[model samples]
Target chain A: MAVDKNLPILIVDDYKTMLRIVRNLLKQVGFDNVEEAMDGSSALTKLRESRFGLIISDWNMEPMTGLQLLREVRADAKLAAIPFIMITAESKTENVIAAKEAGVSNYIVKPFNAETLKSKLQSVLGAF
Target chain B: MTPSNVLAEQKLLRQRIDAAHAEAAQPLSREEVGDIVREVLTTMQGDLSAQDLGLYKELESLARYIQHARREIAAIRPADIRDCHLPTAHDELDAVVGATETATFAIFDACDAIGVIAGGIDGEQGVKLTEQITRIFEACNFQDITGQRITKVVKALKHIEAKVDALVAAFGESALGALEADPEPAGDAALLHGPQLPGNAINQDEIDRLLASFD
Candidate 1:
């Protein structure tokens, strides 16, 4: 199955630079519709306000962490089924397990390239 | 001697002799003996009290000296190290993050511009240039990792600074002022502080292996 190139993707991270990088990488991977949220709280608000086909979130955000956001999304009836991908510099076993338990569709460790992003997207959204 | 004077003198001597005789004839009463002993002890105690007063004064002076030394030490303490130095260090690190982020974004902008230019080309050179742009994007990721690593160092520094400030607050800087500092680790030994931050001890592959266990 071909991945939807027009699928709206939300990329959440506290770092603005990281958001830009992810946006660029997503653009490189042929995903034109991408939205940015600085943190999980804003991401949650965006999720409620609009629909996104996939969520690529950084785990180490303040106020509301990505794992916390994942749990919230999983709990919400409207957003529960949306595929969520966790991206983080924290490549710890416990963090992965926590994200896994929280119903993350896939995980990507940071310093990842566009290829890795595309691969993870394909794993969650089907082959591109 | 005049008869009257002689009689008076004799009478005085007689009285003294008689008193002595009486004292010899009748041993001192237990109450009298006790009074004599008590008097001697009272005198001795008075002497001891004088000696103790000198010792007590010396002790009081020593206590005062200690208090004065503490105040002096506290005065000499670099009171602003925590307030100025540590916080400034943190701010400097924050600035470094900001500067790097700016530079990284600029690099991204150049890469994006090059990417747009590359998109216009029709040959294999364009494809190669596009591939090179992806490499630049990947390489630019160092900014994020560097920022995270610097943040960990900042946090560690902040933690130590907080502890020092707390100790100074509780015990006065004087309490810790006299202590000698331990030598800092050198070379790679400094980095041996056992996985102080996330992703330090383990790699993504190891994490994945561990996660496979959960499955």
Candidate 2:
């Protein structure tokens, strides 16, 4: 399937560094139209306000986590179908299981390069 | 009789009577003595420590608390054997900062290298180089996030230092001030473990094996 590169993707992480890194990786993968949120709460607000093709978020964040965000997105009728990917520093099996139960589309571990990110995006949004 | 002789003889007689009265005074009952001791100990709760048995009891309790705190500290040192502590909280925190520092430095170094390489590029190639540079600039945001995290750690350490200083001030540095053995580093919080160091954390294959076991 052909995925639009201009879909206005949402990238979320509590750490600005990780956010920038992911965003750049997204650019390298052909998606230049993107937006970033610092944490799950802000990401929720952004999701409600804008239509996004994909969401790449970190698992560990204050106030609300990526898993929480995934659950919230799945719960919301307006945002339910948007593809969601979780990026985590934690590779604990329990966390992966939880994210899967919450309807996460894909999972990526931290310290990932652009190539790893590309495959994750491709799995969720189709051929990039 | 002479006035001087009268005074001296009278003083001697008074002294004798006083000595006799003191000797004749009744001994205190154990219950009454207990009450006095309780009162004294109550007054010295946080202020003064005495040499009596009651004070010794209080010291015994306080020593238990100190020992508990010392044990906790010991458990944090990966090198300490008392507790089967591995990768203690201190080590985890240090690893976080160290890893972040190294990664951040690498990012900056890469950007510098790119700049040096970009200098030799001609006009047509400059456009692509500019895009790469822009990406590098965007990636520098890690500094702000890392700074916030490190600041949080420093604040916690400062708070601990203040409490320890107060404890030292309350108890003399010699008996109470003697530093206890360090704690061994061990896993405490299972879920909240951040980026694990190379040897410390299991890789994807291990995680997959764990997952497959359940299946």
Top candidate when judged by lDDT against the true structure: 1
* TM per prediction: 0.67, 0.49
Q: For residues B1-215, what per-residue lDDT tens digits would candidate 2 score against the true structure?
A: 99999999999999999998876553333444456666877777776645566665765566566556654543443222212232254466666766776686688568658867876887868658856765665555455456556657766765665665554444334433244554545676445756766697788999999999999
In order, the interface RMSDs are 1.0, 6.1
Where in model 2 is the C-alpha error above 4 Å? B1-215
Error of 1 at B124 (Å): 0.8
B93-192 per-residue lDDT for model 1 (tens digits): 8877887888998998899899999999999999999999988888888888888899899989978788767647754554546555446789999877
Instruction: State the DockQ, from 0 to 1, for candidate 1.
Output: 0.44
Model 2's CAPRI class is: incorrect
Q: How much does candidate 1 score in TM-score?
A: 0.67
